[model samples]
Target: MRTTDLQLASALGAWRRPGVALARALADAVGGAALDGRLRVGSPLPAERRAAAALGVSRGTLTAALDILRVEGWVDTRHGSGSTLRLPPEAAMRLAPVSAVGEDGAIDLRSAVPAAPHTAYQQALLRAAERSGPVLAESGETGPGLPALRSLIAGRYTEEGLVTRPEQILITSGARAALALLTAHLRPRAAAVEIPAYPAVLAGFRASGTRLAGFRVAADGWDLDQLHDAFRAAAGGVAYLVPDFQNPTGALMPDAARRTVARLAERYRVTVMADETMRDLDLRPAPSPLERIPRAVLVGSAAKTVWGGLRVGWIRGTAALVGELACHPLCEPLSAAPTQQLVAAELLRDPARVLDHRRTALRRQRDHLSGLLAGDSRWRFTVPPGGLALWLRLTDVRSDVVAAQSSAYGLELSPGQSFAADATCAHHLRLPYTSPITTLDRVAAVLDAACGGQGQGPRVPGPGR
Candidate 1:
């Protein structure tokens, strides 16, 4: 076929489907094959004018399609070089899941989700509904969250000696949203993240279009020196730290490191955003670094401790900064769902009643999974003393490929690369032990099939075990 005909044929396939937008369809079509491969090494793509004429799309629409491909890292365009595929089209698709996994169904260990159905949660919901009269019309002292919930969150900090005020609290849609708001305001020239951090956080940063640097968090501890170096390199960019039961690695920042980070931030005049989303949910209560180190932004969410659908999180900082964050542009939907805030408020009001069932269930799940994965030869992990997940480092295989293949066996896995600042995780996976025993056993069986029998793994049971 003539080159012109090939271009026309490709464009035809892209826009032939009805209902689906032409640009998106074009992306889905060329995204998996030709355009993806040709963009990698300064290879020339068909001239825009030629492609547009052949495909019968407006030049503007063709430009939009190329722009979409650029954002997704499929094609690199130059003034003279046209476009070059950065990686194989297949590699681009590798980033997307083959199928969607649901909450009520599937053995999904891809996220460190809190197990559901605790009596405490139902009781909290019931109490909130009883007091729902005031919140029906969205009338409240605090805009996004109920005053009581803010007070409760503030009180927790007060116990740690950080004099906090309810007015300084800005409840957000979720932990991810809270971070995005902060990133919007603190649009620094550059930013830093821990290598193998949370994937969602990584996604947020990408969406925000911020320059990023990455530092390693070691098994022994966070590389404090690397953190200091990163800050120094960025001058005064914001640094995101998950100090308590960190998402993917489950490495709790030590007290000394916390103090050291605070000191460095003060010296360098940089702001630290401490993520405490997984704090109180640990099996053993560990002291939070935010309470000890006052030089940072403290972010918390009920999702990890309670349920993912709660849609409530708070950013705690100096009263002045917190006030600014509350009125930030992102609060447009009027500060989270009112009913959800009301529910969180009721749950905070009676902690013991709301947390009793969750604590028991989490402990049981964590213990059972740890026991099952223990003695397995292919995986190794430092089973977290108190959280919903275990961070396992693969012995020899590449975890990214392994996770990609897991879906075929009815297992959903989170490859460590998803959390890295650079797309490079090949030896790690975050396994949330939130599955029931039977489900966990099934996961173990899959692991066995995937990685040869009784893989040499550590089954750690501390405190709860």
Candidate 2:
């Protein structure tokens, strides 16, 4: 088994199974697929919890299946490692549909994580690995990442009409690390964020010891007037804005509003950190404020468009600020992983091919999940123009209650309040459909059952309701 196949230490306490029954059950389901020419070598198995729920078994049972696959030459087990399919690449195979959560399993749709894709990308990694030694070390005095990567990333902004140089680019581990460095350098006096901001960002700002002041995103879009007032209130410090395909509410700030907010930021002498991580995924044209506001720090990542495993992201701002942020990164993560950067560079080189494949797959999965939600009237969601998740509201105001009950049925979820500043989103929930199309269906079925199905219980009240 390849070293990358497992991060075994993580699998120990939570995943080890003692009985053969659990092992036998797992072997039967996944093994049956393998022998039937379905699951192939290099294919990634679903997470143990996900697989167990889908197969109507315990995690121990799922581990046993993996163990069996190892014994029968259908799968290989790596110590403190990941699982791998032992079947040959030439074997004819079909994706066996599996649910994100089964009747007896807990489905976590709170975060944005695609069910890990099969090992097609492993080919890119292996190819990169062969050239790793020299290429990885050839960055000269700059260390880690090569000049070519920085140039390629800078080219992205140049295409968008912002002239950027490689010297001005500083590649980071991900957007999260980029934000960390930004927060590290800045004084955490008073920072402004959308009322319901990305929870992690809020946590990061809090960790920086910033007094977080919130500006409410209007139900329709960004509340520019409130945003302006908040900036005026904070006077300076930093203001975080997600102008396109925003998390939680899926609100898109109009270009005019964006411009207004930018002007306000300038007027108040505040720095606008515009997070565009989810910007490019828009199914529609998303007007960006950065076009007119050059001072805005554009924090972006490949994690959204490509797989999160790539972990390559960049930050764009004025040359001086970018340089400052670049220097700060050495104190944090230093640089993005050499191997991941190479893979990302390859995908970026031929973005159309990768994007086409990703969009096609995501479109299918998105539609399937939407269809499932549409079948049930107890849930309400906006058909987002773009972005990874759907913000759903229940017909009843008891979302926390429903979420607790759903957990009882083995379905863990993100309650709306978790994403809010004051935790007032008690009536809401964020449903991210990042699992396989089959899993999306299962999640919908479980949600439908939880909501008491079509006009059966409380009618899902609209936003006002």
How does each model score on TM-score?
0.71, 0.72
Candidate 1 structure lDDT: 0.68
What C-alpha lDDT values do all the predictions have?
0.68, 0.64
| Tens-place lDDT digits, model 2, residues 294-322 | 47877888777666767888777667876
- Which prediction has the highest lDDT against the true structure? 1
Candidate with the greatest TM-score versus the true structure: 2
Model 2 residue 270 CA deviation in Å: 1.4
Which ranges of candidate 2 are over 4 A from the true structure?
1-105, 115-120, 136-145, 285-293, 329-334, 375-377, 454-465
TM value for model 2: 0.72
